[model samples]
Target chain A: MTKKKLIYIILFLAPFAFIFLSLFVGRYPLSVPEVARILWGKLIFSAWGLQDISTTIVWDIRLPRAILGALVGGSLAVSGAAFQGLFRNPLVSSGILGVSSGAGFGAALAILLFNTTSYIYIFAFCFGGMAVLFSFLIGKIYNTTPTIMLVLGGVIVSSVFSALISFAKYVADPYNQLPAITFWLMGSLASARYQDIMVAGVPMLLGIAGLIAVRWRINILSMGDREAHTLGLNTALSKGIVVICATLATAGAVCVSGIIGWVGLVIPHIGRMLVGNDNKILIPTSLALGACFLILVDNLGRVISGSEIPLGILTALVGGPFFVYLLKKTKGGGW
Target chain B: MPLVEVSNAGFGYNGRAIFKNINLEVREGEVFCIVGPNGCGKTTFLDCLLGLLKLDQGDILLGGRNIKTIRPPDVAKVLAYVPQSHQKTFPYTVMEIVLMGRASYTGIFSSPSPADISIAEEALAIVGLQEYRNRPYTQLSGGEGQLVMIARALAQKTPVIIMDEPTAHLDFKHELTVLETMVQLVRNTGKSVIMATHFPNHAFYFENNDVPTSVALMDKLTFSVIGRPGEVLSEKNLKSLYRINARVVSYQLDHNTEVKQIIPISTLYSKESERVN
Candidate 1:
């Protein structure tokens, strides 16, 4: 095989290795052979002879967390890449369409009004979708420049939702619900369960698959609207589809993960560095690298302290320094 | 018959008329250059021809069919466009950019096939950029980048290619390089070219040189003159349209070769300053 193909193979396999290795790492700290044996047994013999505590730790806790980490990270990164290309700006992230703030507001409002986890997830998903809808509607109002208008509309919607989140924080019970709301906004996968995965997994999978199918088109869209039209692309419908898919994936990720940041923004650049910016390869590369990065950060959060550090804080802590290093290395002309 | 026809095409936004009463025909295997001062709507007219903008008054026809009736993909199959230089957000390779020209022919869910890849390689070869095929488009010089775009148009394999300021931001060397490539494409491949340019001399590049070319001098939102480069780019028309004191002169440097050169002897304001003195 060619060197690039070999590199891609290694990149793809490295994540699975990390995921497997991570299953053995945690507060419980199961041995590798035991973890493997249990996984094999569960897959083959249906967890009948596996030890109870090991099974619970392996199957119930770490597996779901790892799976959710992979899904959320992959979704965020792919969507970030998609949005960056759609807007033709490398600085854009999946959150640019107001999904994160809208979801944050939804969670905060849920905490103040209902004080339940399911309500938070449901409200977060609904309002996250609503935010992008509003952004699209606002973009359509002008009808002349869709990309610029969508970006402006996103900024407007994001600000309004950010204000609403602040208002919700202001009215929240300081001692009881306030901390919960704050923690959710800070973002964590600590509560990741199989149910959460099943719930958010469908949309995430759909969005990711949609992006992959149309990933090549993202390259065309990045050429700007006039070029895309001249190339015979239906600019409006294609952009709308990309927006919907990316927003769905972003909303799904935020609803489950709370507000994890940086994975979407940083991972795609890393992917671009590894493989050039053919979205066909870049999208998948982003998925793999994002999964690995978030899992590594999450693993650090689990082991580096007495308590579990939030995924959002740890990602920023790591992503911020790494991005600076990347900037320095590339001299700001890498793209 | 003309490969593309723009008949009485007028375009404007809302109620403002950008350009009107535009009648033009681009025949097969010819280089048609549009020359006008800035803001004379050269690009607007090109956009109308590309079907990117609907004409306000009349119609554009490609292959004798109304362009408005042709599907966008069919229009793309017939015509390829090269826009002005702009910063690309992603650093796609030269080959990748060229391969994107086949997107109209490829299924949306599919990528460029081996056939497409070969076509792209052939295009890069045509532009003499085979060595730069793997290079990042963003890392290329302005001239190289413009050539990559031309290679992209060539890969589209269309009969007609439209360019908006193909040599706008290039250095003099690159400008001539692109012009030679344009001339070569027409001479060798029998392709039609419609280019909007700031330089009237570009129209003269293919003039008196055994090449088919036409010049369209635009002024006040309409064509002032359209014919052979030598016929349309007369001293009187150049003086009136550009308000410059210039001459279109031919220089014979060799026994069998001649070149047309636009020499500016003086500016219109020079005589005014002399009178003031």
Candidate 2:
């Protein structure tokens, strides 16, 4: 049919194909029939005609990893698109509100204090949400969340939390907790168990749903607060809703996946190039692209070397240069 | 009743009074022009009427209802605003930009429907920019961008449109196009326009079109004069407000037509010999 419909179909289908491919693409390569048998057996009933190791490889490890990758990638990218539109700045991402740094510190601190497994997720999520709240409250110092002030608030909170994270590292046990914190900060989906997925899924889905619901309003909001107000938009309510949704999505993602960077920042730009800047299409497009991009990147992490490459390192190492290329190709335009 | 009525309305910020004790009215099929120096509260006055800001001393009413009582969405259905400048950050297509005008009617979560799309297309047709519908808005010139913005306001389907410095930063042709579009829209749709502008000639332009034009000059932070463009826009008023001696000249264009324009002669900062005679 139309070009846009074609793009949507491609975007919507790419993730499923990539995820299925990922099921058989690890240290233990399973054949197509084996992977299918494992999936069918595990999903339908008992693991009939499937080996235990094969089923665990397909259902337990790769499935959760791919699904978690999809959720976090979609959430972060969508949050970036929403924040970019709301702030009317192309360079801004959800992390501009200090969510990533805050979550990093929280995870680090949780590791420093408690040996409990779930404490990392809890601390990361709360601190991520709290960091954004602190940024938002700082933005409201002048009784308004003016764009500049909000960005400044994010910068302040980010630096402060960054310093705190550094301090936590210094006092941390170098032999035990230091490596844990460092590995977490470098970011990986090696630990994408069902527990992490279950913990992050609700808020991630909630934020994505909210952003989609308010997607059209982001167009009006990109006109700036005064213009939006004149257009009869309840900007205060709309802006608050956007901030909360973005915060939720961001914090939820950072909690499970640690600090996966650049996907949120770069994926929206790719979506914009494909769909133009209409948030209506750009948002969903970013979602699909982000899901696909992260799955692909995670695949590289699994297969590129003998050991798994950290997602945070891979994303920045690759995406940073690619972002610069996009910036140049766009010639400082299309923002 | 007037579409918008501002009586005894005053607004200020940070312990400074911007404007006070203002009374104004806008009727259907009328062009109400507010001209003043920069930051003379022309935009502030417009914001008050649009219910974006509350009147510090009094109230503004829309079609006999107090403006404060009407919610923003309802007020949007009544009046649309065209700001002085639009950011080019997003490369929104002209059609997408125009479709955003339907946002007032669309639910917060919903997309624009087919009916809204047709309405937006109709707005584009009215502005004669239908061919530019799919072009990136950021790629358009300042004048074309302003037309697209005007088309957006038209798409809102409001009874009145509020514009702040709509003709600013436009070439000669685009300025005339904007003024002509305003006159044509008022004539065709019976929609009133409340425009704040720096150019006194815009009032004369409307008057020349036989549109009922009322020019209000905000001098000394108040309405110094309000009446027909030719009668009220004098050299004395221009000097008092802009601190410049300006000539309000009438040029004979044809056998039966005269064009009125304002030409700045000298500023107070000019050398004595070069000062206005």
Candidate 3:
């Protein structure tokens, strides 16, 4: 095999390795062999001779958290890559259209009104989708100009939702609901469960599959609308599909993991540096690298202190410095 | 019939007329040049021909069919565009950029096959950029970038190519290289070229080719004359169109051959200098 193919193979395997390794690093640590035996027994014999605590740690806590981390990481990075290509700007992220802020507002509102976790997830997902849709509609009002206007609309919607989130914070019960809302916005996968994984995994996977299928066409889209139109692409339809897929993935991720930042913005740039700018390869590369990166960050967050650090803090702390390093190294032209 | 025929085509935006009574024909295997000052609607006319913009008054026909009837992909199949050199936001390799020209041939969900790769390679060879295939497009010089775009159009395998200011940002050597490449495409591959340029001399340069060549001198959003470059690009027309004092001179070579050249002397209006005097 070629060297590049070998590199891709190694990159693809890294995520699985991280997932397996992270399954043993949680607050209730399980040995590697014990975890592996439990996984193998669960998959095959449906029963493991391992202790109840071991099974609980592996099956209930670590597995869901790791899997959810991988799913959210992969989806966010892929969606971020898609948006960057769609906008023809490397600085863009999956949250460019106010999805994160909107989801934050929705979660805050749920905390203030319903005080229910499931309601928070549902409201967050719906509001995230609505935020993107609002931006798209505002952009449509000036159909003659698309990309710039859409960006502007996103800015407008994001600020509005941010204000709403602040308002919700003010009205929230300071001692009871306020901290909960604040913690959720700070972002963590600490409470990830199998149900949360199943609930959010489906849409994230669908969005990922859709992006992978249309990834090659995104190269043409990055050429700008006029060039894409001249190349015979239905610019509006292609762009709309990309935006929808990205929104669905981002919404699903935000609903489960809260507003985990930096994975979407920085992982794709790393992927582009490893594999060139061909979206066909870049999308998958971003998926694998993103999964591995977020899992590593999550593991670090749990193990670094007595209290588990929020994922948003660790990701930005790690990813932000790495991004600066990449800028210095590649001079911001990794593509 | 001409390969592209724009008959009485007019285009306006926001109820303001930009151009009207525009008529032109690009025959097969011809180098058709449109020369006018900036903002004379030359690019708009090309857009109308590409079916990107609908004409306000009349219609454009390609292969005797209404242009609006032909879908964008089908139009792309017939005509390729080489736009001016601009900074690329992403640093795609030359091969990747060239392969994107085959997008019209491939399905939206499908990747380029081996055959498409070969075609792209062949196009790179045509533009003499095969050696630079692995290089990042952003690292290429202005001239090389323009050549890569030409290679992309060549990869499209269209009979007609539309280039908007292909040599605008190039140095003198690059401009000559682009002009020579245009001549070669017309002479060897029998591809028709429709280029919008501000340089009347460029139109005249291609006029030296043996294949058919035509020039359209545009002014006030309409073609003042459209004919053989030698016939249409006269001193009087150049002066009128650009509001400059210039001469279309013929220079004799050592081998008893002659070449047409446009030399501008001065601008018609020097109000600032006049006021100073």
DockQ of each: 0.71, 0.75, 0.70
Note the residue pairs that clash in candidate 1: none
Ranking 1 against 3 by DockQ, winner: 1
- What TM-score against the true fold does each predicted structure earn? 0.96, 0.96, 0.96
In candidate 3, stretches whose alpha carbon ends up further than 4 angstroms from where it belongs are: A47-51, A327-335, B254-256, B270-277
Q: What is the C-alpha lDDT profile of model 2 across A1-335, one tens digit per residue?
A: 49878888998898888888889788997899988877777788773655678888888899999999999999999999999999999889879999999999999999999946599999999999999999989999998778788889999999999999999999999999999999998888888999888889989999999999999999999989887887779998999999999899989988998899899888999888777899998999988988888887888899989999999888877777876887788764454
Candidate with maximal lDDT: 2
lDDT of candidate 3 over B35-124, digit per residue (tens): 999888888888888777888998788889997888788899989999865559889999999998998998978889999999999999
Model 3 accuracy (lDDT, Cα): 0.88
Report the TM-score measured on chain A for model 1: 0.96
Candidate 2 per-residue lDDT, tens place, B1-277, comes to 9998888888899869999888889999998999899988898888888887777898788999998788888899999988899877788999999998887899888999999999999999999999999888988999999999999999999999999999899999999898889999999999999999988889989887788989999966688788888888898888888898888998888877888888887787778416466
| Best-performing candidate as measured by DockQ | 2
Name the 10 consecutive residues with the lowest summed lDDT in model 1 chain B: B268-277
Looking at model 3, residue B180 earns an lDDT score of: 89
Q: Model 3 Cα displacement at B113 (Å)?
A: 1.1
